[model samples]
Target chain A: TQLLEQSPQFLSIQEGENLTVYCNSSSVFSSLQWYRQEPGEGPVLLVTVVTGGEVKKLKRLTFQFGDARKDSSLHITAAQPGDTGLYLCAGSVGTSGSRLTFGEGTQLTVNP
Target chain B: DAGITQSPRHKVTETGTPVTLRCHQTENHRYMYWYRQDPGHGLRLIHYSYGVKDTDKGEVSDGYSVSRSKTEDFLLTLESATSSQTSVYFCAIARGLAGGGETQYFGPGTRLLVL
Candidate 1:
């Protein structure tokens, strides 16, 4: 069984602050994805990193995949109230018929 | 908004009762998936269907069953609901192939409460 672990399960920060969320796993994955879920809604895909050491940016968000493909990170610059939500990291083994193994998620609260 | 919709967005039922959730899509995607989200667990796959009348169990499929009789609709059934099964259910669809890193679009999700 593969598991993805996320750090800082809960985070509360003021506006304009910078925050980083980490996702790590012991098993290697072929691809990793970041998703943001608001309250009472389904998760929305933020980005997908396929290659090792890959970095993708979405506005103020920066996502990086580790060189070993066993970990990933999401960094938000100048966080705002709109950034408050649950952030989840999911990985695909590439051999499990494209099924994704998800992390526990990081709940971020950006106070305005 | 990938043309996916889940019915009965919120449901409350007694334990041991049967419940069914519906997922409808307009994109005619080849793959459809069911997942449940909890407080500690981000999202766990319950079942998936590759095509019409073709489905398979997922990581947490013991208490659930799924059916895909048409290209646009997939149904998830809980024979005997349990309190432990209360969670938010989400339906996702993939447009292209199944294992090629295709992006999946998710529905709004259904919140089920088994008391």
Candidate 2:
């Protein structure tokens, strides 16, 4: 089983601040995905990184996959109150469509 | 978003009782998953089905079982409900992502409490 360790388990910052969360693992992954979950709702996919050393951006947010394919990072710039949520990183070896193994999660709180 | 519905969105059952949670997807997705969410544990997969009648266990599969008789429905059963099982349960359907592997679309989630 692949274990993903997420750093900065809880972070709180004022609006307009910048923050970065990391996901690291000892096992290589075929794909890694980032998801955000709001209170009372299931998680929503933010981005998927399949290639090592790849960088993908969604407005104000950037996701990077490590060169070794064993880690990833999510950076948020100019965060807003709406950006406060639970951020989860899931990795899959994809050897039989194995269900993703999730990180402990980083809880972000952006205050206005 | 694929139309996914989980029955008994809120359930309160007694320990040692059998409880079933149903997940229905209108998109006929090939993959469906059942996961449990806890405070520190995040979300852990309980079971997953690749296709009709084809299912497999995940990292945390004990005390839970799943069945998929049709492509549109996946059922998760707790043979005997326990306090450890009281948590928000989420069902997700996996569909191909534009660039790679698969992306999962989740339901609103079902909250269960075992006393």
Each candidate's DockQ: 0.60, 0.67
List model 2 lDDT by residue over B19-83, tens digit each: 99999999878899999999999999999999999999987899999999999999999999999
Q: Write down the TM-score for model 2.
A: 0.97
Residue runs of model 2 more than 4 Å from their true location after superposition = none
Give the Å shift of residue A27 in candidate 2. Answer: 1.0
A1-112 per-residue lDDT for model 1 (tens digits): 8899998899999999999999999999988889999999999989888889999999999999999999999999999999999999999886334788899999999998
The alpha-carbon deviation from the true structure for residue A102 of candidate 1, after best TM-score superposition, in angstroms, is 0.4
CAPRI grade of model 2: medium
With candidate 1 superimposed using the best TM-score fit, by how many Å does residue B19's alpha carbon deviate from the native?
A: 0.7
DockQ of candidate 1 is 0.60
lDDT per residue as tens, model 1, B51-108: 9999999999999999999999999999999999999999998754344566667899
Candidate 1 chain A TM-score vs. reference chain A: 0.97
lDDT accuracy of residue A14 in candidate 2:
99
**What lDDT would each prediction earn against the true structure?**
0.92, 0.93
Highest TM-score among the candidates is held by which one? 2
Worst 10 residues of 2 chain B by lDDT: B96-105
Off by over 4 Å in 1: A95-97, B96-100
RMSD, candidate 1, Å = 1.9
TM-score of each: 0.95, 0.97
